[model samples]
Target: MPPFDQTRFRLPRGARADAVLAGGVFVVVALGAEGQRLSHGEDSAPSQIASWLLIAAVCGTLLFRRRYPVTAGWFTVLGTGAYYLLSDIDGPLVIVPIVALYALAAQGRMQAAIGMAAAMIIGMAAITLAGSSDVTGTAVFMLTGWLVAVVALGSARHSRLAYAEEEARLRATEERLRIARELHDVIGHNISMINVQAGAALFRLKKDPAQAEEALGAIKASSKETLRELRATLGVLRRVDEQAPTAPAPGLARAAELVASAQLAGLPVRIERTGPERSLSAPVDLAAYRIVQESLTNAAKHSGAGQVTIRLAYGDRELALDIEDDGQGSAARPAGSGGGSGITGMTERARALGGELTAGPRPEGGFAVRARLPYGTTGKPMERSDR
Candidate 1:
């Protein structure tokens, strides 16, 4: 059995290929066996006209072989069995059975193909003993060997298709999660800051006009920046023919930008870092940036804190981050609560890199988030100017 048949007569791709090739095989067999065997004298002779018509009927079913493979396969097996029982001719009329069986299995009808295989083997064994004078088991063995090979090849094709489909599904799922995380980082943080600054701008408008103007300016800047990042986030899904932005991807190097936004939103912020500075792997860097972003977002939105401190401490084996806000100490909600994706996204990111994260209210006061991430292969020593 040929695993692939590239020797083509330019038959159109799908069902037409099966029909044309199978029809041609039937015609060739018919021409080669011009007449039936004159065995057991004229009394037992098979009619030439009847044999040709039976072969035509079986070959015609192959037209729908691809669309209704199981039905076509069964029809071919039954027709071939009838031909063996009735005809006194013996030639390569078995090619139609082989093609039908392959179609059924290659289309993932394993049970149907196996059933046809069993029927073919049984029919051949019975036909060997009844049609020929040779009582030896040689004919039965030979027929079984060839049919088994054809069935196996078709089954292998089915398995390969199944594996490919499963792989595609996994990639699609991963892409969806990646997009979700980007949205949570880009939209959530900026929206929170805008909400705060807009509220402050309105509250202080009459009492302190200059302070109100500053808050309004911060709101405008925050909104514009949000829109820019939103565009960058969505650019990932653009088609090949569409134009996409060429902005650098956000990571730990951009942490200071996040702090500046927080300050503009009327939340005083301080940063402390104690480390031999190094570069980080892309996934780890993005995760680090997102975790810090989401944490600051939560403080500005719900913490009710005036001051927030962000501490970054690096060691030989691990990197540690601590974000604390002197807020209402878990009075509002948990980090990822209120249908928010903040804590969920951060947790997934940390676990993916064999790291861990935790967030809760400190015993004395305020809310704190701590994350410890492995340096692993994702980090390397770099110059201070790299940032």
Candidate 2:
């Protein structure tokens, strides 16, 4: 035998599913009523037919349960009562109203569902007490328990769905922020370099033709590099079925490239290492590289600095970065103080990986950005005093 696919039996929402549910309820209740009529043989043919019609009417109300939940619930409750009062045959027709009660609660009509359920239970209890109904007290108690359970289940499902939607919305917001930071870092750094080179080329066009030619060449190279990085960043947003990019992401291994670009923009940059080098996690490596790139760009554009120094320190648990420049120090614009997001973006990147970054003008007369990033696993973010 083939394996069964349970999904095939799962009813979809809408009129078709409602019709199927109501039809199934009618068939079940009719069969039970017929069985009772045959076994008792007390109801006349006309009376039995009336009972079947009443059962069908009550079950049919379920077809509109999702569209007008409160209205359908009341209809089924009153119809079931009429079926008991007019028919001689006893059956399981009360289930239709129970299904409608659950639908009402699931649609967030809790007050109406509870009201209908209370009315049904009280009316049934009154008829039984008056010596006109055959339903036992125990049956009424069990029915009350079932109604409560169904309403509770519906409310729980609603809460779960709401939580899932909120979580998905939060994830989407975080992804957009990450993408924005990447674009700012990649495009901003290169464009600033190109602008500086263009200005230099224009200033020396006639007085120093060779120097002007070199500046123009640097501008062309920077522009080409900008396009490549931009394409790589945008590729991440493409659909899964599309071909993915093959280029590696920028990391500390490309620190030399940033140095060369900074030099072309007329800022001298030197890299110094203090400890043995070791491979870093992708996130940490990228964060470190971007911090360096942004710092160098700032030095070239804003800081009247003669030289910039980048120092890397490797330890057993963390990698530390120090980028300082012999610039105008406190006289220069502070990081992120000029409405630029470079410093803010760099700080966000570091903190996201359980790291800490601080950028400030040094008391000794230069600007410095310092950061410490951990390896694979997340650790407590170090405090400023610890740094």
lDDT (tens digit, per residue) of candidate 2 on 21-42: 9999998998888898889887
What's the lDDT for residue 107 in model 2? 69
Clashes within 3 Å, all models in order: 1, 0
For model 1, the superposed segments whose C-alpha errors exceed 4 Å read 1-11, 27-46, 134-136, 240-247, 335-340, 376-378, 385-387
| Model 1 pairs in collision | 281-378
Local accuracy by lDDT, each model:
0.81, 0.84
Per-residue lDDT of model 1, residues 160-256, tens digit only: 8989999999899988987888887789899988988888888999999998999888888889888988776665677445455565678888888
User: Model 2: which ten-residue window has the lowest total lDDT?
Assistant: 378-387
Top candidate, metric TM-score = 1
Q: Which candidate is the best by lDDT?
A: 2
The TM-score, computed over Cα atoms with residue i paired to residue i, of candidate 2 is: 0.84
